[model samples]
Target: MATSIESHVVDITTCAICLEKLNIPKYLPCLHTFCESCLRTYITAIFEKEHKQSIECPVCRTTVTISKEVNTPDEWAKVLPLNFLIVGLLEKEKLRDHKTMHGEELKLFCADHHTPCCSMCVSIHHRRCAKVLSIEDAAMEYAKSDEVKYLKTHLANVDYDVKVIIKDRSSAKENIDKDYKRKQRDLEVIFSDLVAKINDLKVRREAELLKIYNEVKETIDTTLIFFQNKQKNIENEKQIIDAAVNMASNVQVMIEVEKLKKQVEEHKQVIQSKTKEIVNYELLLQDVENITKLAEQMEKACQISCKKPNTYIALSSVTVTPNVSEIFSCCRFGQHTCSWGVKGAKQDAICVSLSKEIELYGLLSYVCKDALATCDVTATVKDDTTDLVVVKDTIDSKVAENNTVKIMFPKPVKLLANKKYHVVVVMKGTSWCYAGGDGETVVDSNGVVFTFNNSPLSNNGTNTNAEQIPGFVFKISDEL
Candidate 1:
């Protein structure tokens, strides 16, 4: 058995192509071993001649693929570290032969001299020189030193620090995200409140402006009504005067000799009565002179003018302007000159006595009992006046047994036939003695009182309540 095994082993050790001990043996996947040179040459020749991309093993004709598996030799067992089984299979002599033949030449150089050296030369000659070191010697020493050991320790510390830093970074990022969300919520609430407040203020301002506009409109309307009435009165007065002048001229033309003689006797009485009537009318007109002036004064007090009316009347003829002063006299009384009165008394009560006329108008008719007293009344007539008729009167006060006073004027005088008029009254109480000494003056020393009522009436009739006064009234005629 020993003899037969020796022969088999010898046969396996020899290369089929080279016929030499299989040095640098390369085993195929077919379990056949061959010389490395022979296999390399064969693959090269086949690739060059046939342009084949892959080859088959000689023994089994299995495809010898050139991937990781083919790139490694089957005989790599000889190069690996020896174990008990490996040593038994391959003799020490065969192993040495494999290494000597297959091992690639390794050329080591001195770092300083740049000269190649063998392994024997590195161990003996490069021992003492500082710069004269071999690549192999340096590599071996670096692998075993404390520097390598320290690098290992540093690498472990670095890994631990990196893990701690990563945790902290993640936690900080989470906190930042939470804070940002909170701020976003707060901003939304603040913006909503601001928008609501702005809208409220806008609504309030709009309401206030609307109210002011309405008030202004009402004032404008009132002023317009006042001027419209004045304009109508002016036109009416012009027409009345023209008619009176025409009548007088026609009567003068109708005079005859025989008729004149008989008419002269009758004319005296008629003329006398007519003159009295004229005087009474003139007095009535005079009483309201101050009131008319007051109206004009009141109109002037306002700065704005009335808008022009849609329609207007024209005056056809002019009349002689009467003397307004001849009608009423202004009087001032009292220590402080705080009271104003207008007075005119005529004898013959039937001749429209001033007392009766004053009482009739009810201007100052409140003080009728004290018409004559140790007192004086006064009035003020303003310039550039309009629309106020002032009437003054006195009457007996049933409650106090003293004289009561009154004053009044028209609110808005209407224009009739181109003429407008107003009346105002003013009065004050005075001390009087009956059967005793001077009567005790009432403590109501604030006696200066004035009242005003408006009449659009063309002529003075019975006094009416202010509320009863008609609105604007006028007759429109083309000729005025």
Candidate 2:
């Protein structure tokens, strides 16, 4: 029976074409197996000779169609299904051979190399190592060492510090983008106003030029008509004198000449009186010269200058209540929303303490909405030391946009400095959501230091350690 089993295993493991153990055995639709290299060679030969889209199975002579995804003969064998059963058998055979040749399991730990090894491996490679321990002993020693604890603490601190740095960089980038857009808008307005003024000036100048040209033309036309009338009168007087000379005697001609002489004297007096009006006339215009000067002046009219920004410039000022002042505020860039509550536990709270004495009137929280639905959120401030709910108020979630709504308390409560307080926020219908910047951020504003804590407080005064600290601004009626 053992002989028969050995022969059966050999038949399945060996490739029929190569008559050797399969290296990457692949099977055709006919269930015939061959080595990957042997199959590729056969397929390439058939393709080169026949140039057909199908090939005959080597053992069963069954036709197998090539898929369109198989582009070349070299890829034909790769597209065939792998014989996982044969592969598993081969792996088992390899593992059996490994155990027979190597003679043991990896039960020793080489402390010098920090790796596991068998007896043969230790004798062959780790003979010169200073120390070696059994696996059990090594595990116990590692568990008791302080290295693990120190590493955990160090990694946590480093992660938090890196997150803090990332938050700062993200905020700086957001500020730069906002400032760029603002400056661009300001520049556009300035240029637009300048263009409007230039257009108005152009219209007025053209109208003035036309008015001056019409006045000059009218004066020239009137002067031409006056001179032509005077010439006609002089010619008529000379003609009358000539007619009298031709028709009458010498005495009559003398009388006519005497009468014409008086008229000629009157004509001379009229010409002398009009000599100034009959002088040469020229039209001169200053339109071109004035336009050129204006063009030159406009080039330097609006000067653009830039300098380093000494401080952060907000895009718009937020309108707060009359007497309320903000004490703490977190950045709102890289905006994110954290689930303030999960299933079963629908109430969560963020705890913080102030370093200054003031009358706490209200608080502003940046919230998120799943849809445009009306939802009411209740915020209650509880004193940690006294275990008393100091103040409570409710605000509609629809009004919360970038700290737009101040959820005010019914009455202002005065808390002592250096006291811990928590604001528990509750909402209906779904998990309460709050917006955060960079997931975690720390800020120092208004003489108070605000630190981000990943662990939020539950209703029962226990650390949930699930959600990030919500973004909020503490409002006080008086300045710190």
Candidate 3:
């Protein structure tokens, strides 16, 4: 009987509708108790399934009518009264659950303190809080929950984010490495060019100094030889006088004394004049020293460098050249004419001036007509003043296609900044393909014209024959 009474105590607080401890316990007309949420759900299900406006008790067959004022599903619970007995039992059980192995039970949760506290704690530390629950009730419902599956998912996301950050960092590092190497190469090239120019200047300066040195050395050696010969003649004449004084009569000595004296005087005057001529180069030597010192100071004061690569510049944008006629005669402008070997050889010359250094990366042009078979077409880049050829290329005219194409060099040319280069196109060895053009003409100091029986490849600088065909189009581009 005691055991049975204990079972009733445990079960009394549970609602038959929910099988859980009764929460917000409500009493029906038949004296059946239920949780408010469970009763609402049962009533809704019955109305939906049977079109009934009332619910029958699960334990008893008593039926209760739903009030007309119950507009929402939640309002249905309002018609039922609170089950005070069930509520009292729930409170009693909550206190029992809070009881720990120790005699004291933490029977209250203080909202203001955010903690579960015993009655003593509530009276002292959380006295101002209006409401507090027993620890077992408050902790079960209010504590932020932990679910293993959700925790694992969140941890996986954090790890994935870290990996993505690492990948981004690695890519950034690679880009930095590439940039570093590029800058290093640029520095090396710049210094190399500077060193080369310095060496060239040194060689030229040495040549000039050597010429002056040779002239000065020759003059000094010639003066020394002349003076030395005079000394030998004077010594020989002195010996002859000494011998005459010792052995010959006084008359012989006296006769030669005056004549020899006059001769010695003449030799002395000639030596004095020659000595004056050689000794008067002090001003000239001083000028040379001052010029050298000034040159040294100038070099030290300035950074010497050619123009750096800057804005992108190009050649003619027109891809095609204008022809004189259908058969290609000269219009208001001139046409590039190659009259085979019979007409002899003529060269087409063009000049480009650049303000900054540039790499001759590529060329684009159209070959309007190339019919000659054995003709060799050649091109050259040269300085206008010294005729120093910088680069030269040649192609077999027989194999050239008629469409526009890019002409590439095996190695690109590095053009110095602030200078002009003369470009010459030659048609040689029976080659008779013309680059025709006619609208405008480019006036260049380096442009010239020439006619010769030999191949145009043999020439470097422009001659009197240079002509600019207005409509001719050639394109140039830099690598960077």
**What's the TM-score of each model vs. the native?**
0.18, 0.31, 0.23
What residue runs in model 2 are displaced by over 4 Å at the alpha carbon? 1-6, 99-124, 128-348, 351-480
Compute the lDDT of residue 380 as modeled in candidate 1.
19
Better of 1 and 3 by TM-score: 3
The better-scoring model by lDDT among 1 and 2 is 2
lDDT of residue 286 for candidate 2: 27
**Which prediction has the highest TM-score against the true structure?**
2
lDDT of 1 by residue, 74-180 (tens): 23333322222222223323322311112333234454443335555555665444454444564444345443234334333332332332333344334434433
Off by more than 4 A, model 1: 1-199, 243-376, 379-403, 407-480
Candidate 2 per-residue C-alpha lDDT over 1-480 given as tens digits, one digit per residue, 9 for 90 to 100? 999997898899998888999998999988888899999988888889999989998888999989999989778888787776677566445433312226676567687876657888889999999998875676556556553344334333333333332343345445444544554454344334445666565445445434543444454345444544444444444344444434443333333344455555464444334432322222222233233346556434433232222111111112123232244443323454554432233555666555555565556654435434343555667775354443343344566665335655533556566666776765543545554444433455566555433225555222323342244445432443
Clashes of each: 55, 0, 12
**1-480: candidate 3 lDDT, tens digit per residue:** 999986997686778977888888888898888889998898888878998888899779699888887875578886677766566455434433423323456566665554556778777777889768765555454323332223223333333332332343344344434543453343334334345554454445444434544454455456555555454445445555555445443333433343455555465455435433432111011122233335443233222221212222111111112111111111123344432231345665655555444445334332334444344345555665554433333343444544223444323466565566665555454333344333233322112211111123334323333222111112222323
Q: Which stretches of candidate 3 lie over 4 Å from their true place?
A: 1-348, 354-357, 362-374, 384-407, 416-418, 435-439, 442-479
* lDDT (Cα, 0-100) at 6 in candidate 1: 73
Ranking by lDDT: 2, 3, 1
